[model samples]
Target: MTLLTYRTQARWAVAVVNSKKATAEFYDVETNKRIPRTAWTADMKAFAAEKAANVPKPPFVFRLTIIGWIVVALLAAGFGVMTYETLKPTEQSAEQVAMEQTPVVGDMYFGRFEGAAEPDSLVAISDLGFGWFKIVKVEGDTYFVAKSTDMSKQHQPKEQLESAEFEEEGTPAKIVEQTGWQLTLEAIDESVTFYVTDKK
Candidate 1:
C-alpha cells in the first residue's frame, strides 16, 4: 500500500490511505492541511429524513376505494326500494273478494254503500239506473269527494244541505221518473269498496 504522510514542525504526523473509495477521511496532522477525522452523522440524518418523507399519509388511495364501495351500496339500496314499488300488485284484498261473492240485494247492482251494501232493495229492479230507461240511487258525487292520492290534502265530500242531489257532476246523464221510481246518473269514487266493483 502507498502511504501519503503529513508532518509539521511540532512533530505531529498523519497517514492517508485507501478509505472506501473517495469517502471523506480525517487525519491528526498539525500542518500540511488535511481534513480532520469525523463521523458521518449528516449522512445518517439525511437517510432518516428521506425514509420519513417516503411514508404514505392518511386519506390515501384506500380511502377513495372505501368511498366508492359506499356509493355502490347506496345505489343498490335505492334500486331495491323503487323496484319493489314498481312491481308490487295494487289490487283488492282477499277479504274484499270474499265479501263480494255473497249477494245482499237479490242480484241487483249496488255501486257502493260503505262497509257493505244495503240488505234490502230500495227500488224495483226494472227502475234502477243501471237498466235501460232506469235510474239507480247513489250516495254522493266525485266533484265534492275531493279525489287525491294523499288523504290529508283532500277528503271525499260528506254532507251538504243546500247542494243538489246528483251523480257525476253535469255529465248530461238524463234522469227519468216512471212507475213510482226515478232514474239518476250513477257514479263511482276511489275507495276500497269501489275498487271491488272494478275487479268484477
Candidate 2:
C-alpha cells in the first residue's frame, strides 16, 4: 500500500492505494467524503496544478539597516502628527464665532403680526400673508429692526430680501428698537406668531 496526496480548490485530498492494482481510496479533507474515481473531472488536475503553483511561500524575512529604521521612525512620527492635526479642533474667526452665537446685522426675522395692519394699507395680517424685519443697526445688546413691506398673500419673500442692497429701496415705514430682554418678551407675545431668523 502507498499513500499519495493531491489538492482541489477546497482542500488537500489523500489517497490510500494498492500499488500493484493501481486502485485507490480517495478521501477529501474539506468535505470529509470518500471521492469516487468516476466523479473526478478534468478540472481536478487543473486545480491541483494551480494549488501547487500558489503554495504560500515562507514569510519574507526583513533585516532593516540603521538608516531604514530611522526612516520608518520618522514616517511614524509624521503620521502621528498628521492624525492629531486632523482630529484637533479648528479655531473660528471672530466674525464667524459671533454669527453662530448671536444674530448678525444682516439677519432678518420673518413672522406675522396677528392683528397689525399693513403699513399704508388697511389690510390686516393674514395666515397667507407674512412679513419680515431686517436688522438695520446693532448697538451693544440693542437690535434696531426695520419692518419690511407687508409681503402680500405670499409667505415666501424673494432672495433679494437677503441682500443689504434691498434695504436701500425705500425708507422703512417702522423701526422697532428692542433690547435682548424685550426681544425675549416678544417671543411669548400672542400677537407675534413666529419669528424665524435668516442669517447672512
Candidate 3:
C-alpha cells in the first residue's frame, strides 16, 4: 500500500510506498480526505513513463545562482584581506632592528704621549648633542683620543678631555681610556652605526 499527502501551503508532498506490492494512493489537501488508489499495472506504468518524458528537466538557473554566490563570497573575503594588508602598517623587521641598533658617533683627538711625536688626539661623537671640532695638528705617527666636559669654544680639537694639559706645558689633553661609553641608533639615511663614546 502507498499513500501521498500534498500540503499546498507548505509546498510539500509526503509519500508512503510499498516497494514489494507496487501499489500507491493519492490524498486531498484538507480534512485528511482519501482520494483514490493508483495501481501500478502495465497501463499505468506506460502512462507514467509518457508523463515523465513530457516533463522538463530541472533548470540550470538554481545551480548557476549558487555557484555565482559562492564566487562572490570568495572574492569579497580576498578583497577584505588585501585591504587590511594595505591599510595596516607592518611591524619592524630584524634588519630594521639591526639598523636602529646603530648610533651616530661623533669624535675628536688632542694632546701628546711620551712615545708619540705629535700632540695626542682625542675623538668622540654622540647622538645626544650637536657639536664639531678638528685635529689642530699632528707631528708624530701614533694618536690617542680623550674626552672633556668643558671644551673651549675656539679650541681646534675641542675634545672633552679626561686629563688637562701635559706637564710639558704643550703635551695636550689625554683620554680616560677604559671609561669611554657608547650609544647606538638607526638614522633616516638607513645607516646603522654606533657612537663609540658617549657622555654619561
Candidate 4:
C-alpha cells in the first residue's frame, strides 16, 4: 500500500492506494466519501476548469500617485471657489436698486399739467424738446412754469404749481438737481405721476 495525495471538494487529503483494485480509490478527508480515481477524468477536469473560469476575481483598487492627488485637490479647490462666487450676494443696496429703476427729472413724460386741459401735452421739469411744458424753477415740492400755449415755450408762461410734499415709493431718487425743491416722484405702472404745489 502506498499513500497518495489529491484535492477533494475543499482541501487536499491523503489516501491509501491498494494496488489490488483495478482503479484507485480516493478517500475524502472532510466527508469521508471514497471516490474512484477515475472521477478525475477528462470531463471532470473540464468542469473544474469551467468553475475556476467563472469564479469572481477580487475588485480592482486604484492607487493615486502624488501628482494625481495634487491635481484632484486643485480641482476640488477650484470647484469650491466657483460655488462661493455663484452664491455670493450682490454689492448694490436696496436704495441703489430703486434709484436705478426711477426716471431722471429731465426725462420727458407724456402727460398734461392740471390747467393745461390737453391730454397730449408733453412736459418735463427742464426744457428737453422744443414743444413741451418746461418747469423753469422748482422750490421745495413746488414747480414753477407757465400755462400751455401754441408753442412749447408758451406752455409754461409764468404758471407755477406748488406743494409742500409729494408722494413717493421705494427709495426716493433725485430726478433733478437737488435744488431747494422737494421734487417728489412716484412711479405708477408704466407711467410716473408728478405733483407740484406753490412753494410754501
The best candidate in terms of TM-score: 2
| Candidate 2 C-alpha error for residue 145, in Å | 3.9
Across 1-200, the per-residue lDDT of candidate 4 in tens digits comes to 22133222311132222222122234567767765657576765565556545544423223455666677799999999999999998586554443344233333222233222234657534322122233444445444333223323333422342222222212222244222222333322313333322221
**Would you list the C-alpha lDDT of every candidate in the order shown?**
0.31, 0.46, 0.35, 0.38
Poorest stretch of ten by lDDT in candidate 1: 126-135
Q: After TM-score superposition, what is the CA distance of residue 136 in candidate 4 from its true location, in Å?
A: 13
Per-candidate alpha-carbon RMSD to the true structure: 23.0, 14.4, 17.1, 18.8
Where is model 4 more than 4 Å wrong at Cα?
A: 1-59, 93-200
lDDT of 1 at 100: 45
Model 4 deviation from native, Cα RMSD in Å: 18.8
Query: Model 1: which residue pairs collide?
Result: 129-134, 129-135, 129-136, 135-183, 145-157
Q: Report the error of model 3 at residue 40, Å.
A: 2.2
The residue-level lDDT of candidate 2 at 27 comes to: 64
Candidate 2 lDDT over residue span 3-81, tens digit each = 2343322111222222221223446777767777586667765554555455554233234556666777999999999
